[model samples]
Target: MITVKVPLQEAERAKQELMRQGYFLSGYSVQKEGDHLYFPVKERFDSPYAFEERALEARPEQPQGLRETLKGKLPADVLGRLKTAYDQVGDIAILEIDDKFKGYDATIGKALLDTNPKLRTVLAKATGHEGAYRTQHMRLLAGEDKRVAVHKENGVSLIVDVEAVYFSARLSTERKRIMERVQPGERVLVMFSGCGPYTCTLAKNTEAEEVVGVEINPRGHELAEENSKLNELTNVKNYKGDVREIVPELGEFDRILMPLPRSAETFLDVALGASHQGTIIHFYSFLHEDDYAQADTWIQGVCDRAGRRFELLGSVKCGQQAPRVFRWCTDVKIL
Candidate 1:
């Protein structure tokens, strides 16, 4: 159930009547807009009549603002708006946060705080921006699916839906796992760079000479740039095109990340097209619970064709998408 604070002239009497109908409210306050009342809304109403009566009795439209009515925010709407702002310019990132933590509930800027007559005398400076650019409605797409999250060094948030966490969970150890290992004076190539998470992540952590990432989808490309800026990774450059074309122009790099799980095998030509004899082609592929040997065979075949050998560096159980089986990772070093 969500709580909404409504204003009422006869709040005491209304509270008594509402309690008789299994509804109870006890908070009261007033503002320039008018006297406001606080009420608790049930998670579910018995029938349309129950909902209708509550709205009629409270009249939510009369409130000073509609912010009090929101609860259990949806993630899609914010993600959609983020894509828009990011596409127009790569510097902006969508600040995804709990709806309960937004609006006046959000970190009130000093300007708004200064207007409070009591506060004006206590402070000198009063100003800041959180950069959250959406209002209205919230919901969550929840289920048994795997989860993944992205964050950069620039105090920017990059949340992405990983196909499977068993493989993607590497994100949690950003400071230790991958980001911390990269040194200065290196060139890195990130393919299938969705939202530029890994690309930006590596760039932020490494003192590398250059960091290049390519994403096929427009939304992902836009996010990649935004994420790059979020991490304040000035050296990271993103190509808003397919990796097949972008990889060739990049020439050679010390390390190459082949992150596309669906058909990473097919893109071997592209990886080899830009890679040298000792370049490590980090790849991801989906396999059955017992297909480890088959997966190894597949990797061997890929290595042989390019006249190179592969050494399995690590494997991670990212998370589960199925009841019996889970997502897995195979980090191979190609030489």
Candidate 2:
């Protein structure tokens, strides 16, 4: 029953240091007691710089999900080729298995279930997102046969069909960032709001008077409506169909959210139609590191041509899309 104890504030730094030195246990979450923090370790080791180790009640190490367990079980060559990244929704784990590893899908799925007792199903992604719905196919590798999953984000629950609509758990941070900026009684519009994550998060977390979300995918729209009720958000209004068609009818909004990074630019004209003199717009895009200014420039050009001036509020790298490419968000105010 040995553990590494540190002041609560230094716990994170200590755990990170232990992890860097390959002495930290991956399964147990950091535990806090009064002003002290405890981190589980495999065995006693020399304490780095400012850390101390002491014997404490031994908590059984819980096996973390697939990735960590596979490292010691699988051959180095096979393990190196496998994708360690996956998405978990409710009790399901969604994965993108490479073609070469197709034969081992069942084995991997079982391992995932074994390591993570909470997960009841594992679905292998069969294709990339396509069409207006932005959905892909999934094959059940193990456990339950259902594709429907209820995911929670930023205090709101969203029900989604993995094969019928597109959603990303990776965007949770971005959703929270945008939601935190909304002011009381402000009217907000979320374009391409798959499963209503952004819309519901705003409605539930902020005092916005109304949050309207437009989706092209019927399935996603239906789930969005369900999510609104699930979260008991009376301010959310979901519309089915293309944003281009829906934006024209919704009048002007105090803030507009364009989450479709790759194609958000193409819909700027329609988005502008739903804006007033001081509408705040959150525009998302994917750009290489060197082309960081491209999204802002494009928005400026469009605004200038339409006789509307815009103030660049700020820009940030939301997430990494690939090696050098990143998902960027540019916040601007139309004036």
Candidate 3:
């Protein structure tokens, strides 16, 4: 094998240059000697580093992802239909399988468990989010029978009941984004806070004076309180009730978060009512790409009803809800 011999200090830079010029070979481990390194290459060209013929060990094969693990186990047609994207909440894997691949749930789940040794449970979405709580039904396809899982993100531990409460690990980045924007001594409110993912994340990561969360679902509220205690957060409070009923009584806030994407517009009046001058509100909604301006319109309408002047601070695309539709957060500042 052809190898480029360079000092340990220059090895990284030299290796990058070699790879960029199509000289470095793949699937081989670099060899190290006293104060020197040998990177395998396809062919030797004139260089500052010395060239030598030396045998090198092959690198270990990369671990297979979920789809790669299920390739041979599932039929070609079914495998093509399977979406590899899954939500991993703690040791639980939440999957969404198309109805056409109905009977293969167990097999798919087993393959997932086999591929991921850390996973203790595999659940398939039995139904879409339903009812007032927006909780979805999940079927146990493999592993443990329980639905409870401890999901940790942004330096906080959240105990979530996947079947009883709505939670999304996908929004961890969004939660962190909101947390970073929180100012010191600011009081933050999270409406429709499910299992305290956003509430706990903000309380744990930010310098906010206090963080209050309101959840209508009993299970979600219970877990939110539990999560606050679990993280040993002293500046956190969880309320079990509708935001419309609870937010007004909590008084004014420095910042407010409305995470209910499906119908967050319905509660904009409540959010605006609980805001004071210069208060920043992160209002989330599901809207198509072309109609994203509708979110700003909703905010304007609510501000008009409340007789409060406001400034639109722009929007963020949190995640995709459909092909062309996205979960958007429209940031607004009360004036």
Best by TM-score: 2
**Residue-level lDDT tens digits of model 1 in 1-335:** 33444335434333322432344432322222245554544443331112212322333332111122222232445423321100001111112344443442222222222222221111111122111211122222211122334432322356543221111222333323456556678788888776776776677666888989887766567767877776677998998877777788879887777766556778877876777755666666656677645556777777687787767776654434356464555666666
After superposition, the stretches of candidate 1 with alpha carbons farther than 4 Å from their true spots are: 1-156, 159-170, 174-176
| Model 2 alpha-carbon drift over 4 Å, by segment | 1-29, 33-65, 71-73
State the lDDT of candidate 3 residue by residue for 67-130, as single tens digits: 7778788999888878866787878988888877878988989988986687899999999999
Q: Cα RMSD (Å) per model? A: 18.0, 6.1, 9.6
Give the TM-score comparing model 1 with the true structure, all chains together: 0.50
Q: Count steric clashes of candidate 2.
A: 0
Q: What TM-score do all the candidates reach, one by one?
A: 0.50, 0.84, 0.82
**Candidate 3 error regions (>4 Å):** 1-58
lDDT agreement with native, every candidate: 0.49, 0.82, 0.85
Q: After aligning candidate 3 to the native by TM-score, how far in Å is the CA of 44 from where it should be?
A: 30
lDDT of 2 by residue, 1-335 (tens): 45677766445435434543457676555667798887777777645323445445545665553566777777788988888556777677888888888887887888888865767889999999998889899988899899998876667788978899888766766787888899999999999998898999999999999999999898899999999999999999999998878789989999999999888999888888899999999999999989989998889889888888899999988777889999999999999
- How far does residue 198 in candidate 1 sit from its true spot (Å)? 0.7
Supply every candidate's count of residue pairs whose N, Cα or C atoms clash at under 3 angstroms.
13, 0, 0
